[model samples]
Target chain A: MIRQANAVDFWRGLALVMIFVNHIPGNYYGRFTHASYSISDSADLFVFLAGWALRHLVGTPERQPPTWYLVLRLGGRAVTLYAAQIMITMIALAMLASVAILRDNPLLLEWHNAAAVFHDPIPTHVGLAAITHQLGYFDILPLYVVLMVMAPGIAIVDRFAPNLLLPLSLLIYGITLAVPISIPTWPVDGQWFFNPLAWQLVFVLGFVMARPTGIGGVVRQHIVPIRIVALPILIGFVFVMRYGWWPDPTWFPQPRLFFLFDKTFVTPPRVIQFLALVAVISVAYPTIQRYGPRLVDFLSMLGRNSLYVFCVGSVLSLAGQILRYLYRGDIVIDTVVVIFGIAMMAVTAWLPEWRERVKGRPAPKLAPSS
Target chain B: MPAPFSRDCQVGSTATASESPLPNVAAALRDKRKLKILAIGASPSAGRRSARGGHTGETKDILQQAIRGLDVEMINRGVSGELAAQAAIRIRNEVALHEPELVLWQVGTNDALIYVPLGELEQTIVETLRWLKERKVDVVLVGLQYVDRMAQDDHYRLVRELIRKIAAQENVIAVRRYEAQRLLAQAADSGGGLVPDEFQRSETGYVCLSQYLARAITLGVFGGNLRPRELQNLPPRPQN
Candidate 1:
């Protein structure tokens, strides 16, 4: 039977909410999200959870699917993500253009790195399809698509040479950081907000850490001491983030991406702090499940339908931002936007299961689960 | 075709053109027969052609015409309503990615509008400017637009002044957008014509802006150093 409320679903759901809140810049709720306290925000957690779920999708050795089947399924998922990204981008542009026309404000067309679509349509359209033109705040899915495409290779590496998997991932991550390279956006001449080469490390770390052997085995065995070490690092980062105590990027050596707390490259500081945050936060899942059963079930529902919820939430967040812009943002308006957006996301999540019931089949697996 | 604005309107736009050399740009033009520039900032930095067929591309054309066989390629990375601090991060990333020889940074208005702390804006600009300089990239600081109402706003004045000070201190060319626009408006008012909005949200303004930048870049690069034959193709130096 499908699990009702597990730790993975609960955390993924929480990350989705944080992402929704954070995407709407200047929303009052944004100040309270993980970004305010943690070096790595929902993007990191979301990507990591995606990597964790990959393990479940590929299945355990006893029930492992054929290599060809694994490749096809993962490849299909990547195609789906690419399609979703294109759809959302089109919707976002339509929303922006509609508002610009209704309000007679030509300036609105330029919001979120969108000016190219309006001014330079032909090339920008090609760039958008090629994943070279990503609207701001709507960039994560392209990164997800790229990661998904890399999934087959990752799976093959693990299947053939599991021992070399993480080392290879880390090598790519190191070279990406040391060389300080990024996937450039075309027609606009900027770098990807999420550097895929650098981010694969987090995804690989998630995949490996989700397993019951190797690093994962060692980590499980040393959970208590690990948490003990992690607690202080997490607390220290809270202070570091609160006080803006990061070192100057100029002071850093030639390759500044290595030391700096850059979100795009997923720098070392962010990696270390994020790992620490994970170790510390993992302790709360059991407590949350025991004491907050209703919350867990509600969140688990949303997490189960993550892709749908995420896509819907992205559109809703954009709507919320537009609303906030039209009516100057205030605490009351922000509260309404957040509540309405989240409530709509929950509704979106619930719809899939409702359809499943109507068809008289088992509850459909909306997303990969651990 | 040349821009619609009269030659007189272009005179006395910016302050005395700084004779600072754009060595990288010069070298690129010399060896590769091409100049790659990255323009990054708020709305004004976008030199895209408007629906009304504005002279946005004229900036490239003017540069190309100035030196025979020289190709001027521009990459626009402008996001409207972006603050200086945000643009600084993008500038670094873009510089690393494109490795352009010249960077045209239109700044100040959005930062002033949002009331971003002056210190933060200054630090971000100073650090980024230094970083660009270290990479041997030529920089042109396009100052804030001249808005009649904003002229009285203390923060606006402070922002313009701070950018001017940074440009002077850094020894990079500062396109005196505010001053140039003010001059054009004055000349237009005196001549009994509707002032072409040099910095506002209009195609006419964008056209005039292109000419001003092209003029400034031409002067900053050649600065009486161009061969006499090349000098014949250059515009008359605008008097202060």
Candidate 2:
């Protein structure tokens, strides 16, 4: 069956790749792919795409599963991803420890201890700390799990009680702003490693967009015009931000405009930027669907198995960081190492599909029978 | 010192005879030739005062005035409570704008206080010096010498060594303020220091050494009248 790839899937897949590319330091293509243009906007885009993709894959109002079943499925996925992340983090820590031991540098050893990753003569250090003092910085699994658990309730409200979901989400978002909450950072009381209060807005937004009837469908229809206007506006804004055309005040502690849409908390600037990105991508949907056959297929593979891909990609990047520190020579070698790392991630993503083909397991149908 | 002053006095007297007495006297006494010397330091250089009275006396100004007939214009740009890192950030925009002939860098106290890693501090200093040198500007590094309490600390030793290393590598003048302060402290103990009373009253006070060192640095850079008594104790230099 020749299936039309979902527009949200394409965008979300593209965003995930961008996130990976941006995470890698000094990656040449990072400028184009990274949300560094405006981090808040980039985050919004990721959240919006996530919402769209979830709706597209999980089923809309017309073909909705029971609330309890939906909850179970999402919760299970979240738990699986969390376990996988923990394993990946352990592997990364092990590699870092090996590097430190080999170097004979106490400074490197100190870094591991400071980060709470060092465990020698007893491996229980990582496990013991994982229970009490979670590795917040390197771990997004907990936040993702919380979002997933909340998704079913959001979905139910969207499907059965549309008006209530919109206003309730908006109200919650407003309350969040008024009484800002933060998830505490490890090793520090106030420091939030993942500031859930700020991040929840993104998840809630995704839940709302999962319904097929509202803005998502409207956006998907007018994708072309949105793209034409959005691409130029984004470009112009970047130019103004970079150059002194619209100068940030030197006297001010933080830029006035940046304050409005700061990523430190999910602010209004991010909301606009995300909407703009969505509009532009919606317009380009037809073209992306038509021309980039091979690229789309490869990216779709990444999108379909995002959790596995992300875990593997993170481990590979960590290894690359260790290698770069060890070699400390030519830029060319570093570039080659990064490329190898990316290739490894791509292969790992493709592995499951290859396995499915060998077992003769059919690809899951997009629109399940009612 | 006697010849230069006497020659200038005689010239003033001769000029008053020929020209209108009022205008000629005004011109001779104007002494308005501003010496453009930039004194850049952290808190200590900003804090020094005269031992005698209420008027705060910066050592840079005194040394500049001592060499007044040389037409020296001195600008004191010492900011209080700044480490080497912060100084580096502001240097390109603020400090270098004066187009100073000699930059008297007196910092590193705050760096020690904040416990800035030796490597990072060294990098900041090296980068700062390179930036100045690239513009063909001369730099005279003032070594960080705190009181007896802090002098024995490892951080102070690191800063001292780093300063010496940077000075030698960059081929810049290294003012050994630490050693100079040590000598002054010793002199105060022997009742022969510059501000003996201040030293005697507050044994750990920076008043005497900072003033003397600042004056010595200013004079050394600007060719002033006040002799650097600290430099006299050292071995004689090979005459070029």
Candidate with the greatest TM-score versus the true structure: 1
Backbone clash pairs for candidate 1 read: none
Off by over 4 Å in 1: A361-370, B1-40, B43-81, B88-104, B108-211, B214-240
What lDDT would each prediction earn against the true structure? Answer: 0.77, 0.51
Per-model TM against the reference: 0.77, 0.55
Off by over 4 Å in 2: A1-6, A40-45, A109-114, A119-137, A220-233, A244-261, A360-370, B1-240
lDDT of 2 by residue, B187-222 (tens): 555654433442232322334433443443443443
Please provide, for model 1 over A1-370, each residue's C-alpha lDDT reduced to its tens digit, 9 standing for 90 to 100.
Answer: 3467888889999999999998776678888998899889988999999999999988776788999999999999999999999999999999998987776555456667777677667777888999987888899999999999999999889887888999999999999988867687776666687999999999999999998888888999999999999999999999988886766455666676777777888989999999998888999999988999999988998898899999999998888878866775668888999999889989998888877666866665788777
Per-residue lDDT of candidate 2, residues A1-370 (tens digit)? 2233565556656666666655444445556663656534334555655555567546856677777787788778767866775676677666655764575332232221122223121232433244222332244555565567677777777777776865786677666554544453322112233445566667666756555467556655676777776777666656644552432222223223223434435655556556565555566666876898767776666667667777776676556545544554235645786577667767887788777666766667699668
TM-score of chain A of each: 0.96, 0.80
Model no. 2, DockQ: 0.02
DockQ of each: 0.17, 0.02
